[model samples]
Target: MSTQKPIRKAVFPVAGLGTRFLPATKAIPKELLPIVDRPLIQYAVDEAREAGIEQMIFVTGRGKTAIVEHFDIAYELETTMEERGKDLAVLDPTRATPGDIITVRQQVPLGLGHAIWCARAIVGDEPFAIMLPDELMVGEPGCMKQMVDAYEAVGGNLISVLEVPHDEVSSYGVIDPGEADGALTEVRGLVEKPPADEAPSNKIISGRYILQPEVMRTLETQGKGAGGEIQLTDAMARMIGTQPFHAVTFAGNRYDCGSKTGFVEATLALALERADMGSEIREIAQRLLRD
Candidate 1:
């Protein structure tokens, strides 16, 4: 067994007011929006479970109780379904071992970095994974699983990265890259939302991170940056030299469900892949195209 500290908990920052997805998100937390048969947050949580994360820490905000309830076992529904001979297995993904999942309220919408810092109490001193529910990463073994495997082999702060168009580099936290081999790239530094011409690299952080607990300390004093919010990239940048920082190239398709176009694309992509609905969805898409 590798001697590195095991990643047992995953922090999910779901407090964002999904203004990009409103007015549907008016009452519904954007994370609850469905992709096909599952909500956006469900895909993220499933990815965490795929990596053997034992505890889920959701840093929530006002009007986000629905997210917590989504993972809770429905006693009444299950009992009724049992009487009707319904397969209980469909709900298996919704269940988390009691006490294994918990929530902390991030009272203000400071930034991604601040939201993560809210989970510091639960995370304690152990290394943990962070998943942005808005980014839908699809693969056979899942994206976080790929990062955890790399984390086991190397041991330190790791972020999933993808090479985006240079024009889009200004929209994401990008890494100043160094030595690289295969999927691993040494993180020389990090820049959040830098202008394309100023960006050090085209590789952008793809919303999945395996970070050392020490990041919380850096974040505590981290002043607002890049859009006047405590940028996670800024804190991660501060710890790069002190800790072994690297980026893992995710071998998967990532859909940004946080945006309207990306949300539609994810729905169509996933819907058209389902065994039960693929053919019909394809036909519908074809007919719509002809129309």
Candidate 2:
């Protein structure tokens, strides 16, 4: 067997009360919001599956049952589609085998670290991936697959990063870059939401992460940082010098679907990329802009 354990499980922290898109989010979990034709969580799960993740561990809170039902087989819907002569291939990406998914409840509204900590039991002792449903990345090979390939070569904690404007650095966890190698950057340290002048680098963590199991232990005693809630960045920052920490620059377009602007942009961008509707959407877009 390979000395490095295979990353077979992915933890999805879906417990957040998406206050950003309220009203709509009041009833529906933000993860279920459709980007074009697929929900944001579907993209995350598909990306995880593409990266060879065998089990999906969802850290969910109240009002998130729709997410679980979305992945499970919809008997009536499937039967209706089949009888209506509709191809069920489109639903393939959302369907999961009975035991392939596992869910854990995060009783309170804590931070990202706390949500992930909820799934530590299911993750056990193996390295696992973390996929945030709100960050939708579109790329040729998929973001998680790219990180997995990098993990195979580097074999430690890896996170996907993208260059944001210096002024925008305060909005994300900025990376202090130490060395450069193609798309990989040696992460010297991480500064969570640093001031613009204090940011070490423009590269920001982009939600996809391949982390070692030891990070879970670190979170056990990690105190709340930055946002008054347990922040995953603070825990991972402690592991920097001890482990091989690297940031993989993603070669793709990422949409912050949690925001209104990014959500609209992602929907329009994806719709305009579809072969059947691209031309129509392009014309509509042009017409609207001209008016």
User: Where does model 2 exceed 4 Å of error?
Assistant: none
Clashes of each: 0, 0
In model 1, pairs of residues that clash are: none
TM-scores of the models, in the order given: 0.97, 0.97
* Per-residue lDDT of model 1, residues 1-291, tens digit only: 798999999999999999998899999999999999899999999999889999999999999999999889999999999999999999999987898889999998889999999999999999999999999999978999999999999999999999999999988889999999899999999887899999999999999999999999999988998678998888998898998999999998999998899999999999999999999999999999999
What overall lDDT goes with each candidate model? 0.94, 0.93
Best by lDDT: 1
